[model samples]
Target: MKAILPGSAADTDKPVVLGEAAEPEPAADEAVVAVEAYSVNRGETFQLDGGLERRWAGWRPGKDVAGTVIRAAADGTGPAAGTRVVAHPPAYGWAERVAVPTASLAELPDSLDAVTAAALPLAGITALRLLRAAGPLAGRRVLLTGASGGVGHYLTELAAASGAEITAVTATAERGARLLPLGAVELITSVDEAQGPYDVVFESVGGASLPAALAQLASGGQLVWFGQASREPVALNFFDFFKGPNQARITHFDYTTSDTTYGQDLTALVRLVAAGRLHPEIGSVRDWSRTADIITDLRGRNIRGNAVLTVG
Candidate 1:
């Protein structure tokens, strides 16, 4: 079996390699999936490029995968053999096959292709959960910072459907262009340009962006901080809160820590895609052999949305 793994720490350009791996062994509550396609996420690029340190020597770098069940769980808890599915494995998903827990697996409809299904797990689930955190979007003003990635694409469409007015912040107008049709009322390059008094703020690009978003928070608004793509420390003064409406709050988010089950949320997203209600923006699709190149593109921000790689 072959899987994409982190290369030598000194290798800056090629940070990952399609190397040999042990065949998957499913637990009683897990199924063996024959991976058809997998998507690379922005966070995985950090782990691969050494931007985020690996806690162990042999850490693997994949999370979102779509495939067919090759073996059902011994306990019969998940899809049977030959079922098409999208899954979020605990880890080690960048392989020909992976062992996925039943709780993280969702049967895919025949209408949904593997490439699109592969794009859904991590980013889609995160966006879904973020929207859940925002709660009751109808008639609310929502501000989304760093609104051009996979999560952003999903979040924009999801929030807009809930009747929330969205102001998306991107690094450039061209980078933010696609978000317009997805339901963003306006796009701004900097968070500082956002109109204040938003009911909910989805903040991902941290740094000065954090405080800038806080300044726009409305009375009792909720600002969810998810990622720090800027990789800079956020310095906040006590008076920064006074710039916004009183009692505004900021909540840090981690999708893994969310109460929702992966299978449950993934199924909701898959159903939307099947019904033409949700669209997964696939920026790059290529053979899995080019996985390293895709990772490089993601790190460079050259690839928009999710990047999917097909397995032979």
Candidate 2:
């Protein structure tokens, strides 16, 4: 099996290196999945760049994966061998195969091909969980920043289906076109251009966008901050919070919060895609070997949708 790991010398040209790894075997409650494709997240780049933390030697990267079951659970409790499945592996999913517990598996049907299934788990589940926390957004005005990314795109469609009025913010006109059909009532290239007084904001871009989003919230509105794509620390003053007539609610959401509901929400997302109600927008698809370039694009915010790396 092959996997991605941090390069031995951080000062070298490449921060990540690809090499052979030991194949994993299923534990009694786990199965070995043959990874067909996987998506990239900004968080992974941070780890690879040493921005988030120190990386140990030979530590694997990646989290979201879509593939087929090659080995069934030894306990006979998971999907049988050959079942198509998507999984949020216990880290190190950049490899060709991952040993995953049944609890983390979401069975994918033929209607949902592995290529698309591979792109949904992490972003889709995060979107579902964010909307779930917003609590009945129907008829409410919502602002979604970074609306072209994986989580943003999924959040736009999901929120629209729930009847919320959506104002989506992205970085390019071509990217803006990709969001409209998903039901964004208004699309802008920058958060400064969006008309708000929004009931909720799913904010991904940090720095000024955060304060800009905070300034637009309706009384008692909520802002959900998830990512700092802008690469700047969040800086807001008293006036930013007190400028509004009424108080606004701001909360941070990440994938780990829904530990118990991870599989269930992920399964629901798969079913939604299978039913054609939700679409996982894939921004880029490349052979797994090009992972280095893929990571570069992902870190530069060049990908318009979920970026997938296909395993041969």
Candidate 3:
């Protein structure tokens, strides 16, 4: 089997190397999947940089995978061999084949192809969790920061489907416009212009945007913080935190530590995809051999929607 390994974090400009590794066998409760497609997440670069050193070992980097079940445990609790499925594993999904726990697999609907299913796991599950954390979105005023990114786009579509009024915040004019047709009722280039008092706020960009997002919450609003794309530290004033009319709650979703919760969220996401309520916007599709290029482009934030790599 072939996999990409991180050589040195110091050389961020250079691409990681692709090499051969032994193919893993399925455990008693696991399945070996012949990967057909996998998605490139923004966090892949951070993982390669040793940010997740405490959780994962080795350098194989990928989280979302869509494939066919090639081998299953003897108990047959997992999907049948040759069943199309997608999974969000805690680690090591960037290879020709991967061994994953049976519980992680979600059968891909016949209507959805491998590439699209590959694009759903991480981003879709994150969006589902955010929306659930915020409570019922029906007829509520919802504000989503970083609306142009993967999670943001899915959040926008899901919120809209629930009949929520959406105000999407993008960093650029073009990106803001790009989200309008994707269910964002209104688009703002900056958070300062957001018509506040929102019933719920989904904050994907941290740093200054965190505080700004908090300020827009309505009298009783909930805020879910998922991403730190801004690459800046968030600062909050104690007085504002205690005195704000709306009761604002901040929460972060780390999939590695919350597999049970993530699994449930993935199930809901698969249902949404199957029902045509959620569709991932794909930016680019690269071959599995071009793993380095995918990582490089993601680090630069040059790819759009969610990027996926097609494998055998």
Candidate models: Cα lDDT each = 0.90, 0.84, 0.79
The 10 consecutive residues of candidate 2 with the worst lDDT sum are 6-15
Judging by TM-score, tell me the better candidate of 1 and 2: 1
User: By descending TM-score, how would the candidates be arranged?
Assistant: 1, 2, 3
Shift of residue 11 alpha carbon in model 1, Å? 1.6
**Tens digit per residue, CA lDDT, model 2, 111-210:** 8887798888788888888887788999999999888888888999999999999998888878868788999899888888878789998888898899
302 in model 3: Cα distance from truth in Å? 1.7
Best by lDDT: 1
| TM-score winner, 1 or 3 | 1
Query: Model 3 TM-score?
Result: 0.92
lDDT of 3 by residue, 1-312 (tens): 787666577777644677888888667888888888999887777766665462545647778999898997567777889888888776678888888888877887788888988998888887776776777889999888888778888989888888899999987767556577778889998889998889888887889998888988877677877788876789899898888855677766654454365546666778887887777888889887787777788777676678888976
Q: Residues 42-143, candidate 1, lDDT per residue (tens digit)?
A: 888777766787667667978999999999999979889999999999779999999999999899988999999999999999999998888889999999
